[model samples]
Target: MNTTPLVQGYEVVIGFETHAQLCTRSKIFSRASTAFGAAPNTQACAVDLALPGTLPVMNHQAVVCAIRLGLALGARIAPVSVFARKNYFYPDLPKGYQISQFELPVVQGGVVEFFLGNEKKSVRLVRAHLEEDAGKSLHEDFFGQSGIDLNRAGTPLLEIVTEPDMRSSEEAVAYARELHKIVTWIGICDGNMQEGSFRCDANVSVRQPGQALGTRREIKNLNSFKFMQQAIDYEIRWQIAQIEDGHPIRQATVLFDPDSGETRAMRTKEDAADYRYFPDPDLPPLYISDQMVQEQRALMVELPRSMAARFVAQYGLPEYDAATLTQSQAMAAYFEAVAGGCGQPKLASNWIMGEFSRRLNADGIGVAQAPVAPAQLAALIARICDATISNNAARQVFDALWADPAGEVDAIIDAKGLRQMNDSSALEQIIDAVLAANADHVAQLRAGKDKAFHALVGQVMKASKGQANPQQARDLLRVKLQ
Candidate 1:
């Protein structure tokens, strides 16, 4: 009997559909408040609940936001579009249908480029459209009873759909994170996953090289990065194992069990045809003017990629350092503030990335909320550059400044007595004492023992209570020993 061998490490293809709730005050189609954390059904109105005799009205702010995002992604905006009712049955969806764009999406054909390690990867966006979010279902105690929360119902959502351009879970995650940054930086979405403001769904499949795509599984409602990675990995393995056992992979929606690190079938996947999409009779088609698109485009700030490149070219920083410093808008702004005034770019980068980041992490503070002011930090850097104090002494001053933002840097330096003893006479006495204390090492040094010289430097530092300039002490020791 002949048996087929199991395939190991088959390439996994991943695409993401991210839903970001727009930060708007009112619902997409109604006067209902779109605030989160309201009591059950408190924010719902006649239009949101889809009651009889209620008509859906489009929110102008929601449209503007969607167009802004589309322009930022370099997507083409549709001059006209229509809203279709997506037929679905779910407990959270108060209405039996969801109002979303089907064939006539608001924006189409864009690509987002981000770096994964050193290689640049691009995720092609198929479309980004406006939609109304559904209500929330709360399953507490779970003895077959659940409660529904309608506060989130009718919230405005921008659903971003991506092509299957990613080949691994890590690439998918990196793309998602970059997308999150863009939305947040543009002030479109809060990008808060825990609060359900930003949510992701991953479609995963495996195929041999140069073959048609296989049956894909949709992992739904992943709220965190770790779950996004784990869900895709487990789904890929499960699909591969089924294929190895001569079972065909099925098209379905699945739920991820984070505790068990596995995915279980939810239901059969439905295509657009199954949704019975059609233009809504109650709402009119949207018509956006070219002037509006141009306005939104003009409002876009320097994006992450362009800003990172400028940091490298303008500031003369390495690519890696610039990328790390510009990971967020706040960090980039902080770096710029410190790097201003013709300051040393490399030194500023090192301080911000090293001691500044260390202090922020240790104090449990964010860069935006850091207690240290930019001017104060810049002054400290200036002090180090001018040799007002040793690097070690400057660190002590930094701590003092961190403790009291209003404290003077020079006063702190003087109070801490951290000035380096650079005077030859003052350092000569400490050097003499070190030479007398380590006579054996001194003899070995005269006998051509180069290693003993380091011991003398250590002794000099110790005798001077770590205040002696190491370079000057070493130079004087070498001259005296000769």
Candidate 2:
């Protein structure tokens, strides 16, 4: 087992239950539109409303979504999976029962690999089952009464469950991000957390060393990554405090209050028996052939891990660089363009991961919205590699390109007078002048004082107005001193 992260002498164990809304045109069972932002109750069809004489029909596209996710995660797709009706009562659930895969889920036994900073980590998935989403309850707007929004009703969902493998909140969030990237990259889901397209339920608990597993409380519907970390951290601390006191941690469902940064129990958590799961008599068992799996596999784009491995092997990138670049398909493609254009894969990796990322974060924009095109960055990098400009000068060129993305790098370099002085004789003239003017510093250098050499180089650069290539100046100064 991996080393468990401890909080106040207690080991924290975290697992995740992520619901990915399948990208389809209609509801899972009904033929109603699944588009978002529709008026409440406008999108719900008679079947979704659980009207009498309604027989549920399975959505084939939803099954395809499940198979794609399975292949992406290297999981097994069962030949046949059954749908069960989970008996539950809620204002939003117009059917009074939810159709879900319980006894036999479609996708089974997968691992989601990611990194927490530079440490590679992976979480084993128990299963990912197909299900339909319940409606939404409007508690914020109505006056003292809750309203139902059935627009989300019957939307296809794949509920992915993970084992208790994450030892910290950071690992859990990283795993979630990787899963999100895979789903969005493959076009299975939009991955819009704000729109409720993808959400996580974190099961957090703490136990003493060498003791049995502790009771876990499920934090439900964490919509934001920031809030997910805060809620888990708070829950871990709370559980430790309760154990330190005389109180035992109870199993319950909780909610995170971002305003106060705390978790409060909403209700007692229920086990499988509480739901009274039974095979749905209305729907037959779902069957998948070998041909269907192969078709879905062929349709998938190059998966993130495979792309990352290719970057490491083909581009000579560090594992970290490959992983960072392959965070999204767009990012990886942007990097490949820059690398191919510059023919300097390492330099391309450095700029994209460093200055480019910094600028994007500062502007609150994504990689797609970057003003500096890959070709422009590649040109800048090529200039640096060819000794036409120093790293600092290349940054100046980057700034110019950012301001006017249409500006050519060579034009900007000439316009700003930022090109390095690479001519050896002209540089030799500046070196001679600096040597003649700074005899005292030169004497210190011959006496083996390394600082004097740098001082003379600074003088040469100053005399040339910062255009003199510092390395060439150093080379010329060494020869002159000899």
Candidate 3:
């Protein structure tokens, strides 16, 4: 019932189909290595290539991964499930049919919630089913012909299907990111978009208010968030224009050309009936016992939402701060370590979410690879809290610490001479000098001009080489004036 419109009269309806490549050492059906970047045909074995008389065997580790994801999303883990043969012919599909779940998926009916600028949004998941990946068709590497690389064939994939709940590209991207975090956080997948470990297909459509849903075009293999947003926005605009021009939108598969910044038709999308799905005769029904589910539950870590709530209650942080800190497990751990070390949860949250995140983004690294350790950041925050360094001086110290991650904070503070002037009598001398010098401004303050007092504070800070404690300087100036 959300009516957030993308154009003047049309609302965008979007859903996602995300593929998270499992981290098992071997293929889902075969014993072939699933490691990426192997030479063509080097990793594909007889079982992967569907040689005659070679039957597929399921990987137990893959099931464990599915269970972990289902538990994390609070989804129903079906005690029994079956695999179906998705009939499709493609150059990369060596078997001309993919082994996937259709009628009965392993996980079903979950909800993923995340924040979009302080407004929390939830998307309902249709199912997360296990499947085998098709191989790759290499087009860019050949001069006059395309080649098939079966290295990814039979690789395990968990396809997470979402209901059409997202109304904008922003929501879709946020949903994708949250799902990626869950998979990675639970150690099911590496969440490497570049290596194709995680990817999303967006089903985008434009509909008139209260009308039947429009036909959707599926944008495939959006591996980057920036590209995902651009593709969805461009597709929405294009579909709206088509409708405005009295053209009907066709349901098809499309590819996002990052260079052109537009989506182009790839092929006519195949419906379930067209694929001729049927239960696979080669593999039996998959069954999970009560004990298996219990074991997985024990292995599960606290979800991001639960952890964020705890942060709000225990650390007294705002909901936004809690959510931001819990974006990743490593980030949450770093924040906790800093907060616990310094005993200033709010300040720790501010610095970690602000300066720490900014620098990490600039350096093109994750929280795990940050140069400033939690202990080091905690030391810097402690210095600020104790009035040993002003806010600006702390920033200087932080920059030095980032540059030389092994450098002691106190050593850097002394080397840069950025310590705040906290001695009351010594600060009194500077305030008295400024008061004697700025007689006109002092007269303006006596006449009830607050700006004059601010000007005096600025002069006091400047005279002290920008090392005066801001709050302390303001308080001493007030007392002297009285």
Q: Against the true structure, what is every candidate's RMSD?
A: 3.9, 1.6, 1.5
Give a tens-digit lDDT track for model 1, residues 224-320: 9999989888888898889888999889999999999999999999988999988889889999999998888888888887898999999999887
What TM-score number comes out for model 1? Answer: 0.91
Q: Write the per-residue lDDT of candidate 2 for residues 11-59, one digit (tens) a residue.
A: 8889999999999999999899999998889999999999999989999
Candidates sorted by lDDT, descending order? 3, 2, 1
Instruction: Compose the digit string of candidate 3's lDDT tens values, residues 1-482.
Output: 75475576898999999999999999999999998887898999999999899999999999999999999998999999999999988999989999999999999989999999898889999999999999998886557778899999999999999999999998899999889888998999999999999989999999988898999999999999999999999999999999999999999999999999999999998899999999999999999998999998998898899999999999999999999999999999999999999999999999999999999999999998998999999999999999999999999999999999899999999999898988889999999999999999999999999899999999999999988999999999999999
RMSD of 3: 1.5
Q: Which stretches of candidate 2 lie over 4 Å from their true place?
A: 443-449
- Best candidate per lDDT, number? 3
Q: Which lDDT values do the candidates have, in the order given?
A: 0.87, 0.93, 0.94
Candidate 3 deviant stretches above 4 angstroms: 1-3, 140-142, 446-449
Question: Which model scores highest in TM-score?
Answer: 3
Please give the lDDT score at residue 256 for candidate 1.
97
